[model samples]
Target: MPSPFTLAITGQSLIHHDIRACVDPGFLQIVEILKKADVAFTNFEGTILGRHGGSPMKGSYFGYSDPQVLDALKQAGFNALALANNHAFDLGPPGILSTLEEVRARGFLHAGIGLDRDHAIAPGVAAIRSRLIGLVAMDAGPGPRTMYADNARYRRPSRPGVNQLEVTRIFEADRAAFDMLATIQTTFQISKLERANYAQPDDPPVLDEDAEIDFYGTIFRRADVNRRVIAVDPDSASIHLEAIARARSREQFVIAYLHHHHWEPNWRDVPDWVRAFAHACIDAGANVFVSHGTPVLQPIEIYKRAPIFFGLGNFIFHTEKGETEWSSPDVWKSVVATCAFDPAGPLQIDLLPVALGGEERIEGLDFHERQVPMVASGKIAQQIIDDLAERSAIFGTTIERHGPTGRIQVSEGQR
Candidate 1:
């Protein structure tokens, strides 16, 4: 058996500034925790605009960071990065290539975006302590279809983009409600207009099921209740699972990562589909599963002795000034989780709660200074741990709060 290993994981890092010179005590404290781990992992949530120049493919909230931001992340001790997120393609294919170039130049173990579909779906491997660690990263996007990697076909060349796990939002309505929508569709000739203006020959034939209707681009299915359902593309799921299995077959510790914005109505709630998918990845051979996209912490589950973090929220969130969308206090509270894997013993995880800029706004601090994470202390620390414990309890994963930190120990036979 290989020697015991330690992995430190953080949430999304939407960084836009260079903070290598910051001397804030809180920030330094968080950095110290990360530096102690053998492999520090975090989702690199934005594209890097470097020599491979590209135009913005998005409108408001376009996220593209300078190359120096990687220097700051390296300074903060993040050696493993998941480079698949909604903003990964903010500058289109060129942006994907550029980000890959910069991240590779930094010598970080990175995965997710790649030169083509096959490349993007492959796992990234790194050797640590004479043991191989593999990461398979993907983005479950509710974003544009054009942002995902595609292979060459016919006369078209392959595209460089983020590895995407396609997801579909489905709305289910009862018979009465379904009929009402159908009546409106007929009255307004909605389907006719859609066919005339946007329908393509290759568009999947509308569901022939009597009770299902394709309204505009949304799928509405008939059911006994009114609710929304999130569906993952099975093919995409299989592709990622195969990558994990291949890594596992090579005797590597596999870490499966996902980034998505298909959040539940309540941001704090974990989506059921995401839970199922995480379980599937674990069953396929992943030792650790982590996801992000929602800007607030969700819950953690210990499934079959493998740790699954549904959402860890933001670690380095640098939003634009006056951005009220992510102004919630919960968005700034998260934990830096360190997991220890011992071949002869149980897996132990320590969660160190952190707050952005000490949980209070400083009068003179700018975005970069105020948004850096600091190790949480006092009531705020307890509150963060307590909330996480409450949510994680739903998964039957008990987190023992030890003052400002939380811990979980899963024996080899726990599952």
Candidate 2:
């Protein structure tokens, strides 16, 4: 065994502008912590769509910025990056190719996007501190067909895209909702017959056997209801588990990471499938697990002696543009996670609360502009620590104040 090793983890990073010029001093201190770790990791949220190549999606936008952002990340101590976020396929194949080229050229180990599903699902291996580390990044969603990597056929190759974990949404309507849908089906039948009599070539499928949806046509609206469950596609989970099992035999540690925008009824708790997936990976021999994309800190669970971060929020969230960038408060805060693991297992985990800063955010529009992540102070910092402790309590994890950060307490036996 290579003694004990520490892994520093963080959430999404978007370095659209120059980090050195736009960021402040406190951000550098956080970087110093990351540098001290055996391996430092973060999810790269934006894509390098190049200067003049890609087109945006139909209604929504995909993240794209200068390719030089890779250099900025290297300076921040990110030796490895998760590339399986919603933005992976933003610029199509060219973007995917460009990203892989730049990231690899910069000497960063990244996994997620690939030319086909096999490579996409495969783990990116790194030899850190004489111990082999394997990483597999995936996302359940924030959807569009373009974002997922496709499995290849006998001859034709699969498309270039991000690794995907398919989530099957199962609708379990109650008596009222079920009856209403049935009524809609009956009414739609009459309309279909009328359309057929009126010389329409084909009417829409009233009852979709696969979808369990009763709708008239393509243009329809479905209200938010509780009679449904987000189920993880077992095939996808098993595929990843198989990879982890293989890596475990050959490597010293395996880190499985997921990037999804999915959340539970309250944005605080993790969705059931997320928990299930984390446990499955640990069972398959993953030493550490990570999740991001909620953009807010959502508790932590120590599963089978391994740490599972459901959502780490933003390590560096300098949102200059977004639909609600001007109003959303959740984007301004997050934490930096530090984990110390020895050959036996994990020893200690620390959560340091940090606040995102810049001109756009802060004491209103009057604050000076700069993109940086400052160690939160006073009331703002305590509030984050308190909320995190409350959320993590369900998993039997405790948070005690240690200077400006919170030390996540785990049983000594659990280590």
Candidate 3:
């Protein structure tokens, strides 16, 4: 609504220390490109390690960032961040509190982690120029239960944590798989002694060919037919829908993002629940949908005139000195997405390749060994384009390469 605007986005960035000097000259151009966008977003993983100075907290060190290092992010032009990641609570409540304080003081729009459910789930809006843009963020699981935000009753104070999308797992199988699973579950059984046996009910058993069998609180049918099922908690979906509608009323552009480790067998493909969630977001009035968590790029889906990036991989896949166990070679490569939307023209999307690695840093600022996301070239760049083109093909999304970057082709009707 405010003329033609562009949004540049990226994947997860994990920095435990300041990295102002980590980026080389070529990569600084990409930072400038991000600075020039109307709105720029990224998945800001970890808690802002502020006030505590360089002192470590009582929880896991998986996600702890020095507060001063945020200046480096500000220098690179990241105005918006999503914070409902697995490591949001790695440093516990104190870390969460510090992160909120720093992010607000820096004047960046953020969503997800907060002191209560409403605070965590609420959309963070930014009035950039004359346009009001809103963003809502959540983390879906098959993940650590302790990371979820407290939704305690009015009388009881809510705990500090990240926003959550509840996940209910539904397991299904045919006759053979069902029987095999039952047999396996039986192996862990503890036989009851004769003296420990309790009185039985007088009611007769209800048995049918397609009858339901209850084992260890899991229900399965005896039928031979094949069935596929997924359980997305209705309450969580409804809350997200409500948030989207509320944001739609006050803003010209609404962006929704989710962070999850849920994935399918191919690694590049997303879970069915994620697809359903994306569709639901569009139905609820979101202009763009994005997902991350798995440190590799997944497919892009087009739904109801909106774009959904299932996963954007890792924009800065740095491995800290104490984080040797978290190392993965594939995560070092990623894409910087440039999205253009016009009220009178077709939408356009482009991706620039990046490689995360650097040795330079400011003196006396070393909280941990850090690596910067640099501009990628040669095979590193080519692989990212090829992977995106191949995976995005499933949704009829096309990508073209012109050296180290690629362009996403979308027609007027599709947008």
Which has the greatest lDDT? 1
Clashing pairs in 1: none
Q: What's the TM-score of every candidate structure?
A: 0.95, 0.87, 0.83
- Candidate ranking (lDDT, best to worst): 1, 2, 3
Q: What are the runs in model 1 whose C-alpha is more than 4 Å off?
A: 192-206, 362-369
User: Which scores greater on lDDT, model 1 or model 3?
Assistant: 1
* Deviating ranges (above 4 Å) for candidate 2: 154-156, 189-211, 214-226, 358-370
Global lDDT of model 3: 0.74
lDDT of 2 by residue, 121-222 (tens): 999998887878899889888565556777778895677888988775556665567567767778667455553454322233344554355343321223
Error of 3 at 307 (Å): 1.8
Q: What is the lDDT of residue 319 in candidate 1?
A: 75
Determine which window of 10 residues in candidate 2 has minimal summed lDDT.
Answer: 214-223
lDDT of 2: 0.76
Q: Give each model's whole-structure lDDT.
A: 0.88, 0.76, 0.74
Top TM-score prediction, candidate number: 1
Cα displacement (Å) at residue 269, model 3: 1.7
